[model samples]
Target: MANPVQFLSQVRDQAAKITWPTRREVVTTTIMVFIMATLAAIFFFLVDIAIRTGLTWLLGSVS
Candidate 1:
């Protein structure tokens, strides 16, 4: 088992090995995420509306 000092050293080494994204890359991906989220929300909303309408029509016709 590693002692506290060795564990901290290993953690520091791992942290240094990380390659952070550039500002432009971060911004581009953030925008893409927002666009994808908006599209998904719109698609789900349309699907929900279609299902609701179909169910309503079916129930109404049965009465």
Candidate 2:
């Protein structure tokens, strides 16, 4: 097994290699996600309304 000190040093080295995203990138991506989610919700809402309307009309006519 490797020595604890050596392992910790290796871990530190690997951690330093990571490149985190910039603040601007994070903000832009967050905004895009919210916009896409809103669009999806709106689309589903419209589709649900249309289906409900159609079914109501069909059932109403048969009664």
Candidate 3:
């Protein structure tokens, strides 16, 4: 096993190197994610409706 003290020192050094995003960047990215997710949900909903309608018509016409 490695030395505990040395391991702790290395962990601290690595942690210090991290560059966190600015508040503005975080807000902008979060907003973009929400917008994209909404668009995707709408698109899928429309596609599902179209498929269901097509299937219903096809099955009904066969009767």
Candidate 4:
């Protein structure tokens, strides 16, 4: 079994090497992700409406 103290020391050493993002950077990234997601949702909604309208017209013409 591994020693607990040795494992904790290794964890601490690895943590020290990490470069964490600042609060500003985190907020900016989050906003950009949300904006992109919203745009994608709108684009897919338009596509779905177009497909539905086209199918409706095709079926109506055949009937």
Candidate 5:
């Protein structure tokens, strides 16, 4: 098992090996995530409306 100093040194070495995303990549992904989230919200809203309408019509017919 590594001692504390050796473990910290290993961690530092691993951190240095990380490849961070470019600004353009980060911006593009952020925009895509927002767009997808918006589309998903719209889809769920429409589905909820449809289900509610269906249930209302069915219950009304039973009465």
Candidate 6:
């Protein structure tokens, strides 16, 4: 098993080698994710409403 101290040092070294994203890049990516999520939610909401309306009409016709 590796020693805890050695494992920690390895982790630190790996982290240091990573090239972190700039603030602008992070913000743009975040905005894109939000836009996609919002569009998905809107699409699902419309589908749900359509399904509910169809079911209600069918039930109403049967009664």
Best by TM-score: 3
Summarize candidate 3's per-residue lDDT along 1-63 as a digit string, tens digits: 669999999999999999999999999999999999999999999999999999999999999
Query: Model 6 segments beyond 4 Å from truth?
Result: none
List candidate 1 segments past 4 Å from native.
none
TM values, all candidates: 0.87, 0.83, 0.94, 0.85, 0.90, 0.79
1-63 in candidate 4: lDDT tens per residue?
669999999999999999999999999999999999999999999999999999999999999
Better of 1 and 6 by lDDT: 1
Name model 2 segments beyond 4 Å from true: none
lDDT, candidate 2, 1-63, per-residue tens: 889999999999999999999999999999999999999999999999999999999999999
Residues 1-63 of candidate 1: C-alpha lDDT, one tens digit per residue: 999999999999999999999999999999999999999999999999999999999999999
| Backbone-clash count (model 1) | 0
The weakest ten consecutive residues by lDDT in model 1 span 12-21
- Give the clash total for candidate 3: 0
Evaluate model 4: give its lDDT: 0.98
lDDT of 6 by residue, 5-29 (tens): 9999999999999998999999999
Q: Which residue pairs come into collision in candidate 4?
A: none
List the pairs of residues colliding in candidate 5. Answer: none
Candidate 2: 10-residue stretch with minimal lDDT: 1-10
The alpha-carbon RMSD values of the candidates against the true structure, listed in the order shown, are 1.1, 1.4, 0.8, 1.3, 1.0, 1.6
Taking the candidates one at a time, how many backbone clashes does each contain? 0, 0, 0, 0, 0, 0
Candidate 5's error at 38, in angstroms?
0.6
Query: How high is the lDDT of residue 37 in model 2?
Result: 100
lDDT of 5 by residue, 1-63 (tens): 999999999999999999999999999999999999999999999999999999999999999
Cα lDDT, model 3, residue 4: 98
